[model samples]
Target: MKKLIIFCFAITLFSCNSSAQKTEQKTFEVSKTDAEWKAQLSEMAYYVLREAGTERPFTSPLNKNYKKGVYVCEACDTPLFKSEHKFDSGSGWPSFDREIKGNVAFGSDNKLGYSRDEEHCATCGGHLGHVFNDGPRDTTGKRHCINGVALKFIPKE
Candidate 1:
């Protein structure tokens, strides 16, 4: 009787734990099919925005850009980050200290076997990049490491 009770408890515990891992609730203002995304986005943009692929370091022109502008989502043209918050983190990506409020969404990414906070366009559900703590300590103390291909820089003029 004691052995059966322990076995039942173990089964229940395992079931609960596995169910938690499967919950990934995703919702966005705009959604599209694969073909629609491919038709609208450039090849490189599609890979990073739709498939969450990373661009090579120092490869994006935006990494060296210092123009005053708004960085928008290539997929849905949603305003994401402002140039005033942009910073150079030496990470070979377009780094920002903050994003426009309510335009971005975050999720837990465990693809690398560890949890990472992945950013996405709140409107289109497009993958943007990840955020980190290693940023200018003087400011908001956040490093929004975003991909260049995933964005279109619209100058403030």
Candidate 2:
């Protein structure tokens, strides 16, 4: 009985250690400054990407863009969306069925006197856009309405 109890305690300790290691492994570090971001991105891109401002819809070339590529954050260069996830929502903005894992953080948006979930970059906290429930259920059942100026698409090879 003592041997069995010791074995159980060892297993628990191993499990806890593994779990702690996994948590540590999942943590990511963000290292960038305003000067670096400004130097790397245009003024408009910096406004939308660093200041969390929304760009005017129907004005982004990405809305009508059909290129196959990964859309990365304009400020941080973090991969945010894939071309396969993009779709025409006709909402005068670029829409995506889903986002790259851990790329966006969702929050309650009370802006415009309405309640909606806003999607922002997880890395830089830049407002990429908002999310809607009205989308193709066959996919992720989500409409990630994004600002085209906030993203830079790298065409697939």
Best-fitting candidate, scored by TM-score = 1
Backbone clash pairs for candidate 2 read: none
Q: What is each predicted model's overall lDDT from 0 to 1?
A: 0.92, 0.85
User: What's the lDDT for residue 36 in model 2?
Assistant: 84
In order, how many clashes per candidate?
A: 0, 0
The list of candidate 2 runs beyond 4 A from truth reads: 1-28, 31-36
Model 2 whole-model lDDT (C-alpha atoms): 0.85
The candidate that achieves the highest lDDT relative to the unseen native structure = 1
Model 1 TM-score is 0.88
User: Model 2 over residues 35-134: C-alpha lDDT tens digits?
Assistant: 9878987888888777767878799999999989999987677899999999999999899999999988777777689899988788877778899999
lDDT of 2 at 18: 70
- List runs of model 1 lying over 4 Å from the truth: 1-18
Give per-residue lDDT, candidate 2, residue 29: 52
TM per candidate: 0.88, 0.74
